[model samples]
Target: MSYPAVPRRSAVANAIYGLFNPIPFGFFVAALIFDIIYAKTGTILWAKSAAWLITLGLIFAIIPRLVNLTQVWITSRRFSTGADHVDFWLNVVAIVAAILNAFVHSRDAYAIMPAGVWLSVLTVALIAIGHIIIAVRYSTDREYFHG
Candidate 1:
């Protein structure tokens, strides 16, 4: 029996995505740590730093996500998987939280307190979950054969 052809990923796109995907995670994770520090110390500097970090992370996230969006949803039908869909939604939600956290961080440092910190936590957690899904989706060792 012959199987239908599967769409192969472009090497350039894959390379670009692999190179850029982890960058936003680092920035967002650092932002979460900074948010926690601001909560503890009530430091305006920490709040400002976190806001910058979140902004940078969002910017960095654009490249990999755009690549993924095109590959998974727009350009290729063969590539769709449940984990890909889940990861995509998780990233969308995380980005929203990060944007809200940025706005919250714009307020007085003390005023930002729990909400800003909590938003950061939410964003980081979502991003982490998304990453985990991607990792597991690709790392599985099992193979299936159709007859």
Candidate 2:
């Protein structure tokens, strides 16, 4: 069924969204780097930092992404059919993986990033690759949101 079109957000709202949109990519990179350091050095500090960054990234980027899907559908009044359709699910899976990963750090001196941590980082990377592909393949697609 068709949905009603929502009014466009104000300039301030758009500005705020612009601020939030690119956060996950940076956080994902930071988390991976932290995890790698922990894995290689067996440092609990790095492990705990990775866990905290992942949690923050999950809150700041992934959750807002889901909310953006609703915002776009509301403002545009229709679901996107091509790359955006696939992008949505990719993001969902990555976000869920990240949430699980955020809880995998140990509360001890030993660096303990469990399998879930790697899974989260990998899924987020996959999501990154997916967006890159979409950008390259559909550079002119009007409906595409550039992250």
Candidate 3:
């Protein structure tokens, strides 16, 4: 079996990636806030707006991080390394939760708004924060976090 070569990234590139890493959470938080406002107002408009924001955030902001994960996975396919397992599952949960919330919001999903808010906060926000922390901690050029 052949492993794909992982290209070395410069510190500037890593820092840039680190900066971009949190943007999804930022938008996810915005969506959560918008959802809260919708819940408080009992209006579909805010919910719909939040859904779109989540969709956009997931597509543009979070997707790059997912791609980076793929790159890292190829570099180090070590899922059973407990930490790796947790991180992998968290990322999966985050994506699934975000997509689920967006779908529900767009289609008037019947779940409680607060429940959705909690899900976003727990899964999406937390996972993104984890990424931000890892990126910042391992921002050095020679080796990315897999060290």
Candidate 4:
């Protein structure tokens, strides 16, 4: 019986790939931290709820990353050329969305309410699309490995 060899990766690439393995857990931790902070700060109940909801969304967002990490850990053992770039952009979009949400809730008018709403909506949509793409790619790659 013959078995396929695992793809080799450099130390740095392996370490970077490994770093992503905990993204889901880290996201959960971050969400909990945000919830605690918001609650402690005495923000309005609605604001606290918003923070919690956003955190939940973040947890959802991390699922695809976790899936990709599993594939990399078991097979490639490296970040694919575009994976890191995709992660970076996805994070950027998420952060921008979060900032826009904060601005909208703060009511300080740092950004116009309409603009903030649009930004937040666009960011969320981008994040969702990115996750779907990553999840599909990871599943496909995993199947290739097993086959």
- The most accurate candidate by TM-score is 1
Q: How many residue pairs clash in each candidate?
A: 0, 0, 0, 0
**C-alpha TM-scores of all predictions:** 0.89, 0.72, 0.64, 0.46
Q: Write the per-residue lDDT of candidate 1 for residues 70-114, one digit (tens) a residue.
A: 888987746678888899889989989989988998887588888
lDDT, model 4, position 122:
60
Q: Which candidate leads the pack in lDDT? A: 1
Alpha carbon lDDT of each predicted model: 0.86, 0.67, 0.65, 0.52
- Model 4: ten consecutive residues of lowest lDDT: 108-117
lDDT by residue for model 3 (1-147), tens: 564455454465457556776677777888888877877787777777787788877876555565556545654454223344455566667878888777666555445477667766765666865666555544642254244
- Give one digit per residue, the lDDT tens place, for model 2 in 1-147: 554453355465456656886787678778888877877788677877877887778778745574557655555435344565566667778877776676565445453555745765676686797578568656654343433
For residues 1-118, could you state the per-residue lDDT of candidate 4 as single tens digits?
6756655555664475456534533443444444445445644553445445555555555545554455444445454546645754675566557655555555532223344345
- Displacement of residue 67 (Cα, Å) in model 2 is 4.4
Worst window of 10 by summed lDDT in candidate 2: 138-147
Residue 117's lDDT within candidate 1 is 81
Per-model root-mean-square deviation over C-alphas: 2.6, 5.8, 6.7, 8.4
Model with the higher TM-score, candidate 1 or 2: 1
- Candidate 1 has a TM-score of 0.89
Off by over 4 Å in 4: 1-78, 108-112
Question: Residue 109 error for model 1, in Å?
Answer: 2.0
Ranking, TM-score, top scorer first: 1, 2, 3, 4
Against the true structure, candidate 4 has what lDDT?
A: 0.52
